[model samples]
Target: MKTAVLITIGDEILSGNTVDTNSNFIATQLKEIGIKVLSIFTIPDEESAIIATLKKAFGMADVVFTTGGLGPTKDDITKKAYADFFEDEMVFSDEVYEHLRTYLEKRNRLWILDHNRDQAMVLSKAKIFLNFYGTAPCMILEKNGVYCFSLPGVPYEVKPLVKDQIIPFLKEKLALDSIVTRIVSVVDIPESILSETIEEWELALPKHISLSYLPIGSRVKLRLTGTGKSRTILEKELDSEIQKLIPLIGENIIATHEDKIEKILGELLIGKKLTISVAESCTGGELAHLITSVAGSSAYFLGGIVTYATQKKIDILNVNPRTVEDFTVVSEQVATEMATGCQSLFKTDIAVSTTGVAGPGRGEDGKDVGTVFYTVRIEGGEVTSKLFLPHLERLDFMNFVSQKILQDIVSLLIKKNKSPQLY
Candidate 1:
């Protein structure tokens, strides 16, 4: 496989003030075209650091990509570093200047062209790729048969440069193989046992195919990746292997395609023609957010309510005040009532509810941190579950509970016919 290295140059990233999302995005784009990212380095804006990292990156991989330190300001010294690294001198490019002037004039900001004119300066040996989104141009240089692409730090600019320009250039220049992958999401099973159950099938896999077990919350995703010269053949090979492995754990498999639980839930709801809503407490609308994160969720996601206070739960959801007074707010009884009330209020086919204590401290009712009770009411039947995860922090607890709730919803829908209670 062709290998590449990614270098992120920014003191803000090293200081944790700015997140390095460019490396991840660029690496993913490269992977889709069959380039394997070997290593990633995050360094400061210092010219010495840039030159040193470039040397290391070029030595490590066939291609090197750098993001950041391309602005007009003095701290943006990547251009100077590139000149020194390539033993070249800086030269003004009228082509780049005209592009910049036209770009700014179109935005009615041509008066500031002189102030940003330094952006038109380029290394004499470098090839310039115009930046339609921003002032800084993408520069490419070669050293000892290795290519390095320098890009601006802004994500918006980096995205188009990598996706629209650099990726096509690399594809045309290199002879690359095709890589295809499929994700099988499994639930209600432990990773070790699941692996052992499929060990026979896993060991019989072809050399070009690989499997990875990714455990998130309460679900395990089996990623089957195949690489070859032909994408069609690889996909068929992967599907064949999955069919062989299905009988081993078919009951545990929730989805054979989608990687995310929310997407899996969305597909099931849409396929079954079901409408759903949520009543969130300690989970605090996280369930709704996850559901709506999918495109076209409006087809099944009717609405949501976040009844955080005890009074709102009682007044709005019509939770019996006596139930909370007797069992506290974070109980299974309250969760069931909330789901029933939400289903009635929204008139959706399915209503989900969460009542939990996600906190650095104990809940108001003295319930320990990370105590959650969630209910999924479908039609006239309901299922309520409880989880106590004191090991997780507040945010993590909330997220885990929300993910588990969605996963359970998917599971219930899949087994709705088998289970008479859900009908």
Candidate 2:
């Protein structure tokens, strides 16, 4: 496989002022076209630092891709650094000047300063790719049979250049093949236990296929990637491996496709033609937000109630006052009542509730922080409640509980036909 290195230049990234997303975007694109990214470097915009990083990166791989510091500002010296590193000087390009002039004129940016026009300066002996999206042009330099591409750091500029220009150039230059990837998401199973259970099946996989586990919230994503001369063969091999894995871990797998928990849950509800509602306390409307985030969610998601106050839960959802007085707002009994109340309020087929104390400190009834009780109720059937104590931060705790609630809902739906109590 062809190999490449990515370098992102910005002091903001190091100081945490800005997150470096350019490297990830470039790396993923490279991988899809059969270029393996060896390493990624993040550095300041200092010319000497950029030169040093570029030299080291070019030494390690066939291609070096750098983003950032290609603007008109004083801090943008990536172009100068490239000139110095290549033992060349900057040369003004009339073609680039006209391109910049037309770009600025069309945008009604008539108050163009000299610095803005300086974007036409080019590195001598380098190939230039015009940036359709921004002022800074993409640059390509070749030395000792290695190629280095310098792209604008702005994500919008980088995306079009990579997709329209860089990808095509690299494809013809490297003669790359497509890389196919498939995802199978499993939930309610710890990674360690899942690995142990599927060790034998995993070991029997073909050499070209690789499996990676990525954990999100309470779910584990099994990413299967296969690269070969033909995309058809790679997909077939990946699908065959997935089928083999099904018998081993299919029961634990909530989604066989690459989608978030909410989308997967939404699909399940839509497939079964079931309508749902939610009653939330500590998680607020987070559960509702997740459900409604999916497109066409109105088809299955009826509505939700954020009964943050215990009195609201009692008065609005008609939870028995005695129940909260005896079991507390964060108790399983309260969660169950909330779910049942939601079913009645929305008149839906299914309902879920989240009652928790997602806090930096303890909540009422002596419940510790991150203490959450979840309930999923089938309108005419049984209710399942689970207590999850993840001890996460306030927002994280809310997000995790929302995901867990959806997970529990999917699990119950999967077993509703098998279990007499669930039906």
Candidate 3:
């Protein structure tokens, strides 16, 4: 397989002011084209650092991709680094200059073209891929039979350049194999135990097939990847291997295809023709947000309410004020009442509720931070659970609780019927 290294160039990324989303996007695109990403490097925009990283990347992989540090203010540093590394000189490109002029003119910002004129400079020995979405163009240079592609930092520009130009170029130039993958999401089991249980099946796998255990929240996702020349053969091989894995851990598996819990729940709800609603407190509207994030979620998602305050919960979801007074708003009793009220209010087949203290400070009722009580109500039957996760921060606490709630709901739906519709 063709291997590549992704280098993210920016101080903002290193300082956590900006995330390095480009590496992940580029890596995924490369993986689809049968190129395996070997390493990812995030470094500041220094010419010495860029050149050093380029040398290391060229030594390690057949292809190298770098994103960021291509803006008008910083292009000189990156360009000089590329030229220094590739034994070339910076040369002005009339074609790139005209393209930039057109791009700015169309946007009616041609007045600043002189200030942005440096964006037209390119390595004398490099091939230029015109950037349609931005001023900075993608530069591709080759050294000792290895290829390096330097792309703009902006995600929108990076996406189109990789999709329309770079990916197609690599596909046409290389004899790439097909990579197929399948994910089995397992719940109610620890990762260590699950790994031990599937040890035999994992060991007996084919040479081209590989397995990875990815633990997300309370679920263990067994990602089985197959790589070969033929896509059809790889897919069939993956299916056959998954079928062999069913007997050992079939009962614990919530999904065999979908990766995200929200998407998995969405599929289950659509299959069962069920409508769902949520009443959230400490989790804010994250539970509702996750539900609606999936496409066509409106088919099954009725509505949601975020009753953060105790009185709001009592007023909107009709949680009994006496129950809140007795249980202090973050108890299982209040969670169950919220779920029931949400079910009645939305008139949906399923209702989910979360009442927790997600904070750096304690709740109004003095409940400790990360103390969550959630209930998943289905057709009048309900399951209430509690979790005390004092270690998690506010946002993480919300997200983790929301994920667990969705997973629990999916599990309940699956277990409620003898034969659940998973598709």
Give the TM-score of each candidate.
Answer: 0.94, 0.87, 0.97
Looking at candidate 2, the ten consecutive residues that score lowest on lDDT are: 414-423
The lDDT-based order of candidates, best leading, equals 1, 3, 2
* Model 3, C-alpha of 343: deviation from truth (Å): 1.6
Q: Which ten residues in a row have the lowest lDDT in candidate 1?
A: 414-423
Candidate 2: lDDT over CA atoms? 0.86
lDDT of 2 at 257: 64
Q: Measured by TM-score, how close is model 3 to the native structure?
A: 0.97
Cα deviation of 154 in candidate 1 (Å)? 1.6
Best by TM-score: 3
Output the lDDT of residue 401, model 3: 93
Q: Give all candidate RMSDs, comma-separated.
A: 2.6, 3.6, 1.3
What's the C-alpha lDDT at position 204 in model 3? 98
How much lDDT does each candidate structure score?
Answer: 0.92, 0.86, 0.91
User: What is candidate 2's CA lDDT for residue 349?
Assistant: 96
Predicted candidate 2 versus true structure: per-residue lDDT over 52-119, tens digit per residue: 99889878998999999988889999988998899988989888888888888889885783658779
Model 3 error, position 417 (Å):
2.3
Better of 1 and 2 by TM-score: 1
